[model samples]
Target: MAVYKVYAPPAPPTGGAASPEHFVFVRESFSWAAFLIPLPWMLYRRLWIVLAFYCLAAVAMALLAGSELAPVSMALGVLTPFVLGFEGNALRGWSLDRRGYTLEGVAEGRRRDDAEIRFFTRWVGGHAAAPQQPTPGPAARTLPITTLRETPTGIVGLFPTAGTQT
Candidate 1:
């Protein structure tokens, strides 16, 4: 099979409450190879400059905003790309099926709401399904990973969404 897109249905029971639930169709990226293929080209194009600027901005915002607001500043700075990278290029989900695994890429113009983030859940246990061969299209779309942990809702990222306010 060519691995188009693999997704497992969300858990059926919510503590046996028997309420309605939504299936989260997660689409992980292909591989580092996908990025690696363009690594040399990116370096040649001085893409590092963008990364450097992002780091510099993060630090500047953190310092100027103070620890309390620094995280917010840093988040907003990073989120700009998600909001404006592609069209609205926002990665909807991530996958750990392939040998290298992959995360979704931002859409081509789908902007995110500036409202305070309530929460986000990226993956769920025993429910993670492998995408079909070949993967899905470049478009960013997925079902939704609602039950990521034992908890009903949570967000996944470089850092877990625990201990953070909405």
Candidate 2:
């Protein structure tokens, strides 16, 4: 199953048709296209900062490799694109974050469309976590009270226990 990362676009103005259902799912797996065409992929995604860093790194590598470590530089040149492929999603996510996309959740499926469908099915069909319901009785009326007591094991507290659970 391919992992998918869900994103919610920035909320619209207070009066607009804003909704939780308007979510987008992008595959969180490595991109073979990005690996094969790093520059073009970066351009397509508008990953300016990442592209800048890549260019700078390439230039530095080229300058440093002049004649001393051609093989090392050659290897790095080949490896960089692969690294970009593996981290393409992260780069895209970072760009999305910068552009006001919030990470909502993650899911897995057979493909991007399938993953999106699964996420939406869960999100919109009541399969996701339900809102907390108010408990019955006076639990809501009274403020919770807690006390700490020293035990043979250690300090115990969140609830003032009359005794140990055992």
Candidate 3:
């Protein structure tokens, strides 16, 4: 099952709740496309800041590749895709947050649509219920606090009372 983090945009300046259409569901999992083609994936997601950082890293690595640290740069280049695959979704979520999106809740399902349906169903149902106040009741009695007696030196086992050594 896949888990998704649901994000809702900030309310409009007109003073009403944001539309459901604006809600975003970010899947919490490794992205194959992100690993295979990070540039296109970032472009599609509109993750400008992350893309910028990625470009900077790439440039740095490229510079290093031409120097004595070629092996280290090559290693980083190889690992970059795996890092993107794992953290791409998280970066998307961060982008959403930067755009004033608040984390609404988490949903789990086999697919995104299934998760969306399940989340909205529960969300609507919760909103439909009317809240009720608790009625006053008689005060309950409190239990008395008791202190245990200290065991004498060398005494052991579970006895009703502390025992002294023979």
For each candidate in turn, give its C-alpha RMSD to the true structure in angstroms.
24.1, 7.6, 5.8
Q: Report the lDDT tens digits of candidate 3 across residue range 1-166.
A: 9999999988899987888887899999998989999999999999999999999999999999999999999999999999999999999999999999999888899999999887887776223223356765677556665434443343445663445434
The lDDT for every candidate, in the order shown, is: 0.37, 0.77, 0.86
TM per candidate:
0.21, 0.67, 0.76
Q: How should the candidates be ordered by TM-score, best one leading? A: 3, 2, 1
Error of 1 at 82 (Å): 0.9
- The 10 consecutive residues of candidate 1 with the worst lDDT sum are 111-120
Per-residue error (Å), model 3, residue 116: 0.9
Residue-by-residue lDDT tens digits, candidate 2, 21-131: 666676877889789988898898789999999999899889868978888888999899889888988888888899888887787898777877666666643235544
Kindly give the number of clashing pairs for every candidate.
28, 0, 0
Point out where model 1 deviates above 4 Å.
1-45, 65-68, 71-75, 87-166
Candidate 3: RMSD over Cα atoms?
5.8
> Could you give candidate 1's per-residue lDDT for residues 9-56 as a string of tens digits?
333455432111332222222333223333343244334544455567
* Superposition error at 109 for model 2 (Å): 1.7
Clashes of 3: 0
Better of 2 and 3 by TM-score: 3
